[model samples]
Target: MGSAALFFFLEPDNALLSDVNGDLVNAFTAVRDHPIAVHNRLKKLPTGSDSYYKTRAVDPDELPPLDAAARFIYLNRFCFNGLYRTNTAGKFNVPYSPSKTGRIPSREKLIEVSQKLQGKRILQADYAKILGSHVRRSDFIYLDPPYAVENRRIFKQYGPHVFGSSDMEELASCLEKIDAKEASFLLSYAYSREALDLFGGWTTHRVYAQRNIAGFVKHRRRACELLVTNIC
Candidate 1:
């Protein structure tokens, strides 16, 4: 999110938007304020490749007009690790992923992001309901819901509350409605034929994404992902 903000600053003129499913809103809000310095420091502090900066770097002044810049949505469940699991009380219960470098919440970035998103509305609701009212033409929607197969463990293994098979079906239905409304939309998911069948009409493009998991290789490992889009 911070990287997107910084990139907007460098090469302005684009409306920034992020769909963070509930859990990470505070972190998202924090980084949107002043992502430059902190993101830079994070890059320098963490030993990584040069491309890191290139990916996150953005212009400061050229950032889109705050009022008209980018926007963010705090949707669905707002808890942690995007667990998509809930407790008996219907609260998200994803535990935080601890980092050795400690929490990196950038206050200024959140403020800046908040300011840029002045007129934007941030609501917490189901994907179907949210898109039902907000989707419109000229809007670009990015959907990164948990993979149906990978996320299925939450039913009994992970916890009581989860997206489950029905939730995935509903998500697909929602995206179809958006497509019907003439809104351009993009979806990211594991590259599986069954997953592709979910969005039957959309063209799927294969893309590589680096998965960053804690206690792992510490280097981003490449994995094949599918980008389902109705644009083409």
Candidate 2:
């Protein structure tokens, strides 16, 4: 089970909904091993096409209705590895792995997800909505934003306004509001002290995450991430 799936399992009482901004949602699609199919289907771009790979926009009008207990969020699609960078126009621009390995598209799992998520709301929107009027007291909020520290200065990582310090502060304020409401919530972030300071009073725990490194051999790096929570 993946993070999105895990969310459903953890909060079974609440309806499941996700706001996938980038191509991470492609994980729910059928797996395709062919080079062309992988390139076109997962990345949403034609091979050799001038248009660089970018995150596809989801229309808000097509979203489902939210039950009172439903939790909402903008999820980065779960591509094979969790690459969550975007382009200037807020498009997903992660490159493909040369391994030629087919991803587990997990149709049955997604269909299960769909069944469990019936009447739940998931749509692409600004973070403000996630922390806005829609979110209230007693809600269980979880935030899993991009965690790479290098995103700050890397030219390749720069996007319109995907994730940054300002976004972090805004999230902090949101969390504070949630806290005021006595809602249960958990946040995942790079284990940076600054991040800890942002979410005052929340206890942090370390979790091992296997992340991908950009290279030909397809290396995996075991790194530490922080999980801050108010639900204990």
Candidate 3:
């Protein structure tokens, strides 16, 4: 649920939002349940290399839900390229991004998001389990799994257990199950041979997007993405 951008765009009345990132899920919950508290906490955070590193050094688990959520938002806003890469020890090691303005989302925005998230089920669970248990006929599912190109090294942002080629196979199987259940779904993935092979015979469209995961602008490039859907 990288940003859950599509979900915000659609804004359906009923939905189940799930991601494998527990911190992200907790942040979303905090925002939904205590937007004012989170916003107040965020307002107290100072923005600078010293402040950023000091906040990063503190374990989010040691803080309350609102503080943890605020810390997550602050780090995400100031981290390198806005990436969430962690070291082998599961420590968020993304360096400070001087380019970022170090501005947190507005209180109004958090309240608006909180309203949108109300009555929606948010959970930190595997995609397969969420898809298997919650999907039903006529449901519209949007899948944006982590980039997993075969025989290539990409930024591993989701920690050591990042999605890999094997997980892509499981995602394909999940797609098949969704198709069998007669639910319409769309999948956005990096345009690669593995993606093509796994999701062939679907309505696929190629699209270009700016790659920002690179730590420097010089390394950024235009990347092709595949939009595979099963809607008539």
- TM-scores of the models, in the order given: 0.57, 0.62, 0.94
The true-versus-predicted C-alpha distance at residue 231 of model 3, in Å, is 1.5
lDDT of 1 by residue, 1-232 (tens): 2124333454334443444334333334434454454344443333232332322233222333231121111111111322234456544343333333223335465456556654444444555666887788777776666555653332332334534566767878877888888888888777776677786667889999876431235323676788888888
Give candidate 3 misplaced runs (Cα > 4 Å). none
Task: Record all residue pairs in model 3 with backbone atoms less than 3 Å apart, i.e. clashing.
Answer: none
Model 3: per-residue lDDT, tens digit, 80-127?
A: 878777788787888898575467999999999999999998999989
The CA lDDT of each predicted structure is: 0.50, 0.49, 0.87
Q: RMSD to native for every prediction? A: 10.9, 8.4, 1.6
Give the alpha carbon lDDT tens digit for every residue of 1-232 in model 2: 1246456667566533444343332222212112223323333322221222222233322432221001011122323233445667665555543233223334454345555555555544565575665666678777776553544342234355666665778777777777887777788777776786776467778898765532222334565778888887
The Cα RMSD of model 3 versus the native structure comes to 1.6
The CA root-mean-square deviation of candidate 2, after full C-alpha superposition on the true structure, stands at 8.4
Q: How close to the true structure is residue 17 of candidate 1, measured as C-alpha lDDT?
A: 42
Best-matching candidate per TM-score: 3
RMSD of 1: 10.9
Q: Rank the candidates by lDDT, best first.
A: 3, 1, 2
Clashes of 1: 19
**Least accurate 10 contiguous residues by lDDT in model 1:** 68-77
- Evaluate model 3: give its TM-score: 0.94
